[model samples]
Target: MTASSSAQTPGKKDALAGREDAYNGFLIDLEGLPSSPEALLASLRASEAVWRERAYRGIWLRLPKRLAGSTGAAVEAGFEFHHAEKEYLMLTRWMVEGQPDALPPNASHQVGIGACVVNEHGKILAVRELYGPLRGTGVWKLPTGLVHVGEDITETAEREVLEETGVRARFAGVLGVRQAHNVAFGKSDMFFLVALTPEPGQTELRPQLEELEGACWMDPAELTEQPHFVKRPLFQSMLRACRDWAEGRPAALHQRKITSDDEQRRDLILLRSTGGEDGEL
Candidate 1:
């Protein structure tokens, strides 16, 4: 296998050369390399020495799918698997000692919420987006948006529905959870399925023209017949679950009781006795 290197300081031949984009260290791109464990071991050992001598912060070794066989070598050499996709596997090793055992505290997963709003007539609220990855695909989906800081998941669902369809609904409970890797801009995403019902007076549909082409209530039969919707079995399943919930079926509780700072400490003690600590009954 052949290996090539790039650095912030072009003329410098040191592998551990400092660089602004290297997270205070260097990066080794190992794409399109042959799957040879021996060659990978040799490269990793050499890189480790350079990192120690230069006192770099960290090093990232990116291995494409073709070189996936070399992953064992990387791990043995103290590189942790950061993330992976169908195209590549990313691994990183910190040169500094005493790093935390877990991922950096700042590492986070993107949280999103999808509102499954159904009316008393057994019709579900759906919207067509004016622009997105699935725009013009004729796919109608529930209103969804990212969860902002200090915002609850249920509140996010309600806000997204109001902003996209101009319909205010009450949160019922959680329907399900969906996790996808490398979904949005290479970040892992967690989507909560929140159930909602129309409030006493809010039944009118007013689509947000900037993001939605149209908003309407669709019957279950129509949803099943739609070609695009039929292609997505998960949407069909969620619709059925939401409909059941609207018809008085029970759902998992997603809401929690609010408590004062002093009460919060006591609540933690109670939770420990109720199997919350070990996640058992």
Candidate 2:
């Protein structure tokens, strides 16, 4: 008999009955399964017989957030936690007795950065994307982009601001962090908020034709009052923080420096202990 034919058992019916030939194993879709530990344990035990009979390669168990309580029972049945998202968790049980090359790969989170630039006039710099989820939706947001490899997060914010809107800005500090799971393209995304101060003598607004349709400096009051901005929690939170900073309230931002292996220390010259010019730390 062929390998596929040999893997099938006769006169046995379980979760693996119909799908045996397709996936070469059983998949316990625990979406609507009972959340009780006892029920989960029973289900896992019943699948073990089919696993041994078929000599299956692997068994997958998907656990939604609602059934999180069944995790212990799954672990007890030799299932290991694999990956998780905001909605569900994935676990795997290897039926084969030998070692495998590597464990199942988990999803990676993508890091993004947004620049929140506020000029001396207390107006916030915003952009309207030429194409995106909010394209032509009258939704104007802060200039944001993904952090490129080997680039500092703060520097990424500065670059994105300049690219989308022709505005030179000095990095002030971080404002906050935002995270979302299973975002566009089934990937988890993270955003870092970088505050910036506009450089002197640069005030013209020029939007990048490729990504942005319009770019301009918006008054903080007008920004908060916009119907579109009111619906987004991120923008609302940023408006509050900007208002506080404008009122002389100190920003709760921490300063950080980007360093690399090839970074060189600044040169220093010292006269004496009593009268010294400078010395590098």
Candidate 3:
């Protein structure tokens, strides 16, 4: 990263060492920051003036919790709270006139995916979690898991089913989606109900003991035997939807190759369908 030309401030060399981003915004480095709030404020003022003179669009700066006391310095320099973390706070300022902020906002949604894996016998694959609210409730649920960063939903669905039930399955397509708020870490969640075909001879029991009490190819009717399972309308609907796909309805889910964040890549797979009833495969 390159610092401003006048960054050599006699004693504090490169006190405002930051580099311009692609959009002409300056991103301040956390290292070599000014020591005290007063010093910080002075450095910020100097940097702001230099950036403005150089036609930089905005400034993005992050301060660790230890230096949170210096937040006043940044605020005094017209920086606004962009977002925050337990360990740090980010502040941003728009230096240009009549243009929108170029930086993207913080992430707000979490995604989870599960698979409805059925065997030739037509029983759905399910698992009983070792600890969550369903531990000993006799409620068998489709093995579901949160999507890891950058993980494809299909990959998450297939992996979760295999990890929880030891069933090798191939991603078929999505069945439906269940959305809820105030879940894990208090974030909103999008749960993708997916359908997977069991790989040949891949049906067996090998429950992951750490996260599951047991796993089985459960008859859909057996779920009703558990009083707790009957009340879960979401799972009930998922069962219905999966059966629809199995019973010769057009696949409700189909994969489309979409462009990834990088403009040059068009191989990211997205699962979509024709509403809830039927879709063209």
Q: In each prediction, how many residue pairs overlap at the backbone (N, C-alpha, C within less than 3 A)?
A: 0, 0, 0
What is the per-residue lDDT of model 3 for residues 1-281, given as tens digits with 9 covering 90 to 100? Answer: 32444322222443488666667677787886776999999888777657766787778888999899999999998999988979999999988778777666776679998677877777788788878787777677788888997788888888888778778898877778888998866678898888888889987689999988788877767754467746777666777776665554545567765667766776645445664532342
Residues 1-281 of candidate 2 have per-residue lDDT tens digits of: 11233333323443323234344655554443656878777767766876787676777677888888889988998889877878988888877777682434675778898787888777889888988788889877778898886666767878888888899897765666788899867889988776788899769988999888899888777767789878878778877776655444544554434345475633222122222212311
Model 1: per-residue Cα lDDT over 1-281, one tens digit each: 11223444323343322333423556664442336877777666755666676666767677888778888988988889877768988787777788753324333579998888888787888888988776998777778899997677877888999999989997766777888898866778888888888887677889999998899988756755678656778777876776676566755554543456875531211111231322332
- The better-scoring model by TM-score among 1 and 2 is 1
TM-score top scorer: 3
Ranking of models by lDDT: 3, 2, 1
* TM per prediction: 0.57, 0.55, 0.74
Cα lDDT of candidate 1 equals 0.70
TM-score of 1: 0.57
Whole-model lDDT values for every prediction? 0.70, 0.71, 0.76
Provide the lDDT at 275 for model 3.
47
| Candidate achieving higher TM-score, 2 or 3 | 3
Q: Clash pairs of candidate 1?
A: none
lDDT of 3: 0.76
